[model samples]
Target: MAPSLVAVDQLTVDVITDNVSDTYASKPPFAVSELANIMQAGAQEISGTTLLVANLGYGLRLTTRQGSKEHVLLFDTGTEGAAFLRNCRNLALDLGTVEEVAITHGHWDHMGALEAAVGAIVARRGQGNVTVNVNPGMFNERGVLLQNGTIFPAARVPTPAQLEAWGARVSNDGDARLLLDGHFYYSGEIPRVTSFETGREDHLCRRDNSEEWRPDPYLMDERMLVVNVRDLGLIVFSACSHAGIVNVCTEVRRLFPDIPIHAVMAACISAA
Candidate 1:
């Protein structure tokens, strides 16, 4: 049987922390890209010192609406806490409105600001315990292997305890599930199914801080977020597709054969 559509009336994704943006370019349809951002922000002050900063990471603020009700979901936290918060403030994002957060993977570039982001959410909401989705496999120590057989460690991400201290209610599981009142679907551990798409092969990881390092090419812990729009079909958010963007889209299609993928966000080939 086909799964029922988790339909949403509207969806808007703000690229909170990406590697690039066309803010300075004279974008078509929207005259003066700078003014477009400023006008869209309303009363929020937009200035050179307070402009959004692009980082060598990926993050997004996804807002979905159905009639009067709205849901906000934070996908990934970017590479650095200062940059992530700075971008959020520049965009005038209300962290309290973020009902759920899905950390796409454990790589620092995607989750370095998890703690600070969760704390900001809690601070604005006047409480702790903001739910966050994660996979246990991503918590292991990871690194990249050099030609000399020595492994250079990757940036460390927050642990369950650290995230908890910052008011995050961690859900570290391996199964796929719905989020944001079923408006979004957080995928389970992705199954590598493509012939041409493998994974980042040089990435090495150890299950423990002092364990023997092994080839952790596939990054099995990474997950994707999917939202089915009213007319556009499925929109998938795959941050730093270490699993290959094609494989990610294929998996989404396999899960919801009826919902044609309309768009993909943060789909990138990770060299690190």
Candidate 2:
């Protein structure tokens, strides 16, 4: 059965870090660009210092409201600390209010600034005040195959113990459950069922230093964060969509067949 979810009156997604920062492009009424956000945060003029840094990574600050109550969650933390921290500062976000964090996958691009972020949060909220959600499968060392046929290992995400040591209450269990008073649905292992949406063959991983590198194209550890908004429906947030957005949406559909999917916010790659 689908887990019970609280219907939020509104949802706001703040893009703290991403691959691009195109503020001049046309956007929907419900959408705001980087420049607008910076200016709204009291930027006098649009300059290098005033603008948010764009990096080869992704991160989002999700804020949801249900009547008078509000909840905030962090999804991923981008590829590094400097860029992520700079962007957050430019946006004037108060990480202290963040109640939980949900890492979409094990990729460094999605979790590189995790320690820095947790430090910021814990600095204001105090030790062990925030919860970071993750699964055990994501702790393995991952790499990519280069064109020359050599493996280029990626930076590993911090261990659960490291996160705990850094003042975050790490939830390392692999279970689909409601989070932050049911305002968000943190999915478990996403099932891959799409035909053409096969994962990247260059991806590889090793359980430990003793284990040999093996193909890890399908990142089963990848999960999606879903928010049920009042009158609108589900707003799914997939970090890299390494599990394939189709499979991600399919799993959401299967989970809540009665709810309509309002939108999917993520970095989508074309299968074709």
- The clash count for each model shown is 0, 0
TM-score of 2: 0.97
- Report the C-alpha lDDT of model 2 over 1-272, residue by residue, as the tens digit: 35479989999999998888877668888888888888888899978899988788889999999988999999999989999888889999999999999998898989999989999999999998999999999999999999999999998889999999999999999988899889999998888888978898999999988999999988889889999999999998987788888888899999999999999899654341
Best by lDDT: 2
Q: Which sections of candidate 2 miss by over 4 Å?
A: 1-3, 270-272
Give the TM-score comparing model 1 with the true structure, all chains together: 0.91
lDDT of 1 at 75: 91
Please give the RMSD of candidate 1 to the true structure: 2.6
> Among all windows of ten consecutive residues in candidate 2, which has the lowest summed lDDT?
263-272
Model 1 residue-pair collision total: 0
Task: Look at candidate 1 and give me any clashing residue pairs.
Answer: none
lDDT of 2 at 51: 93
> How well is each residue in 194-252 modelled by candidate 1, as lDDT tens digits?
77776777888887776898988889998999998888898888888888887887788
